[model samples]
Target: MKQNIYNFFLMKYSREKIALLISGKASFIALFSLIIIFSFLADKFFSLSNLTNILDLSAILLLTSTAMTFILMLGSIDLSVEGIAGLTGVVGALMVKNFSNSNDYGLLSIIICILLGAIFGLLNGIIFTKLKIPSFMTTLGLGAVASGVCILSTRGYPVIITDQTIRGLAHIKLLGGVIPLLFVIAITINLLIWFVSERTILGRHVIAIGGDEAIAKDLGIKINLVKIMVFAISGAIFGLAGMLLVAKLGAGDIRNPYGLLFDSIAAPLIGGIAITGGIGKIPHAAIGAITLTILRNGMVLLGINPYIQQSVVGTIIILTVAITIERKKIGVIK
Candidate 1:
């Protein structure tokens, strides 16, 4: 019995398990370490109000990053998030009782925005799979189109959302105002994605396809269907994030999602998700978003220049990608 227990402990600490542990917790470890450092350095960094602000800001990025995780898991990329988000925000606002429109669709506007996002995503999938377009180029073009649509819808003007109920939802708080309702909603969405990724056959297929698309195709997996569904789901999430952003800001501007594309891409990449694909968790992306939010918030508190902060984030992305990406799998750097 003693020998068996010792052997079990040894196996638990084996190289494979050790590597898995490191890979799984690397982002989390970095997050906590940064928190500690910032707490010691900035006088107000660890305050409850500041922490709540971080969580609130993290909610939007968390939603977008979660969506991106699905596409990344399939060894594909979605550059259309910002554009889709901007389009949905403008459309949703216009449909609701807002400054620019007399129509009052209420909850239906939200549904329509999400559906619009899904449609665009489906189109992306169809173009990529049927037309044989590279995902990067296809998504980039689609993004541009979506941004154009947003601009046309607003005529280069911002639309103020005056619906009290929608704005109230954004301001709602729980746990003595330490947690925003929007953040709670974002967390719930993340949990659902995690469940799907971990428990469903569709999720397994995504990983298998990412691991080896040729083998997955040969094995009778419906590659096009899966890719399309993933993109649609991602687009819907992006739409929801956009709607939430509108509520938070009380306006729908064409430029609302301008900087989100890079942040969404960076979060998953920093969270140990392979750029080559096939290895990552949904929760990892959320943690990465939180880590980034904390970093940015701490920097602001410490009086760091915003441009310098962007440079630091860019540097971190380069370093993390270099270390975490599966270089052995790709024969060529390009």
Candidate 2:
């Protein structure tokens, strides 16, 4: 009887392991399929200039998506990405040499922007935990408040930057001019995050809570603290993204981060991170970011209308969620 039971459990574990492997590989399969299709549809897709542009464009999205991965892993959402990024971009723009301001803090301004993002994220965590607000609602309200502040402070005008040093971040390329410098910076930060997720106790606790909150509580994990820390970290990345946006656009404007919320959320799901959380890795987010970037680049190359492109993203998000959501947890649709 004991041997029979051992064999039975072994069979069950093997089946589950197989399923997980297939699910993990799905994103890579989709990404390669996208590349093949786009290469044929867009003649310039393989050219150095166009490939460099894709890398450049993917940089900001990559940062934001990695941040989003943490929050999503906690079974929470952050809709304030655009708002925080916009606010920091506008602030960073005004702090540096700009047509709209007299300040020129140079590199110091970048630090301040990232710190500001952390503050905003910290506030989100405190409010959500203390007030028992839903993460989505809390982030949404805060994001709107941030956007309002950006618009009100700037009076709807973009702060055009005059700092050439910072602006060079967008123009500089590496690796035979096929990779943007910004992409390198973004990748470095993401590597640090990946380490945190894979190597730290905090990372394990995050996955623990997402997998089973009650069990995590019984395990003596400080769930609230972990959630708060994750939010603050995500916010800092948003802040950095804002600064990068200013560099790339050569200006700070509330409108500059228009599609950020969608792209950040979409990338992880596309990369095969389960919406239900606790079942993804850092590399999944990287794959997702690159895949989404390529998707957008291909759409532009194909001359698709900007409006329709949004619809495609929305469809992808819905489809990805449907496929990856934990069905047992979602017994019925409200």
TM-score of each: 0.93, 0.93
Cα lDDT tens digits for candidate 1, 99-215: 776888877877888899889899888898889898888989998999998898788898898887777878998998899998999889888998998778688778767766876
- Count of clashes, each model: 0, 0
Q: Candidate 1: where is the Cα deviation over 4 Å?
A: 1-20
lDDT tens digits by residue: candidate 2, 20-109:
456569889989999999999999998888888888989999999999988888888999999999999999999999987689999888
Model 1 weakest 10-residue run by lDDT: 5-14
- TM-score, cand. 2 vs. native: 0.93
In model 1, how large is the Cα lDDT of residue 248?
Answer: 88
